[model samples]
Target: MTETSTVLRTGRKFDQVLKGAREVFMADGFEGASVDDIAKAANVSKATLYSYFPDKRLLFREVVQTECGRMSEQILSMVDETQPAREVLTVAAQQLAAFLISRFAQQIFRICVAERDRFPELGRAFYEAGPRNGCKQLMDYLEKAIAKGELQIDDVELAAEQFSELCKAKLWMEVAFGVRTSVEQAEIDVVAHSAVDMFMARYGV
Candidate 1:
């Protein structure tokens, strides 16, 4: 076979493992999930799964990083210099808030916390992979906005963090604990606008 076919075959198997791992992890949570479970779900041999991911924790992290990477792309695409800061941030805030309370995000958070004692680095790695990645994107946008005189900010990092936290507002804690299960778009809009309001009060030009 050609090199291209070999590459495609390898990539296909790699994706199958990830899809299986994600389903198993989401269903069983990290601590309870095993390599055998994932391999069975993926329709691959245990040895094949091991070849792709030697460790379960590494597999879990890869699942999260892959998901977060997709989301980061969507969020970053919203940052348009042609639009005003308020317009751009309002949309970003809504999307960020929605994702924060999403089942996927909540499960990842729960898994990291539940297994933190055994694998403290997993929590930190997840935070860096998802939250820090998003924070950096927001920071980059803020920095560009400041350079263009669209906003005034003394600390871009703090502002980025604050904006995301503000977007979370009342929804994050409630959703994480099962006190709430769903959020309406109207509510998201309200929270996003409020977050933008507070952020602008501090940093708007």
Candidate 2:
């Protein structure tokens, strides 16, 4: 295979492994899941699974990171310089909420909460790879907006964090507590608009 093709194949295999790990972890929890089950779910041999991931814990960590990374990328891509600040912020928040409400996200949250005691490292990894990275990305975007005179903020980092918290507050709580059944797109839109309004009132130019 050409180098590009090889890279693509490797990425596809990794994605397959991540998807399998998500199913197994969600169904069996961290403690109950096995490497064999993940391999079966991915339709790959144990050797292939091991080649991609050294161990089950590592596989789970990768799964969390991949999900969080995907969400972060989506949110980042939604920012548009040509758009109004409020509109940009609203879209970003809505995208973030949609990501958090996804089945993969909910499953990752459950895994972290349930396995925290047993796998403290996994919990730390999740927080660092997911929330911390997400907050950093938001802060970077907000800082750029402020520098461009689109926003007026004394503390970009704090504002970014608050923006995320506001948008995610209810959905996150519901997901964490297993009370959220389905969040409609309309509800997401409302929350996103409200968050944008509140944020703009505080920092908009």
Candidate 3:
């Protein structure tokens, strides 16, 4: 095979393995799932799975991290420097809520909670790599808004974290427990509006 074709095939196999791992982790839980099952689901051998992910823990970590990164990227991409603070916040909140309501969010949260006792490091890694990084990004946006006089905030980091909590509260609980049957656009609008309203009440000049 040509070098480019070989690279593309390898990348496709890696994606297949990752998708398989997510399915196994979601269905069997982190500790209950085995590498062989994942390989079977991915139609790859154990050696191939191991080559792609050194261990199951690492595979699970990558799954969570990939989902979180996608969410963060979506939120970050929506930020417009020239837009009003409230508008930017509304957009960001909507993006965040949408992400928190996804199937991947539900599965990742389940894995984190289930594996906390057996693999505390996995839980910590999830928090640090996902929410913590997201909070930092929010803080950066808040700081810029404050500097621009678009918003007033004494504690940007604290405000950012609070904003996240406000945006995620209901949907997060629903996702974490698999309670919500669906999270509609109406729900997203309601949560985003409420979150933006509260945030503005505190920070608007």
Best of the candidates, lDDT: 1
Q: Which ten residues in a row have the lowest lDDT in candidate 2?
A: 1-10
Better of 1 and 3 by TM-score: 1
Angstrom error of the Cα, residue 16, model 1: value is: 1.0
Which portions of model 3 miss their true places by more than 4 Å? 1-12
CA deviation > 4 Å runs, candidate 1:
1-10
Across 38-145, the per-residue lDDT of candidate 1 in tens digits comes to 999998999888776767777877888889998898877766767998999988998998899888999999989998898887788789989998999889889988
**Could you give the candidate ranking by TM-score, starting with the highest?**
1, 3, 2
The lDDT-based order of candidates, best leading, equals 1, 3, 2
TM per prediction: 0.92, 0.86, 0.89
lDDT tens per residue, model 2, 45-94:
89898777766777777777777887777776767857767777787888
What's the residue-level lDDT of 42 in candidate 2? 92
- Residue-by-residue lDDT tens digits, candidate 3, 1-205: 2111222126568888878887898798888889999999889999888776765777877777777887787777778868998899999988887877777766767778877887887788689878899899888888888999888888888998999899886877876666877878998889989999999999987
How good is model 3 by TM-score? Answer: 0.89
Which candidate should be chosen as best, given TM-score against the real structure?
Answer: 1
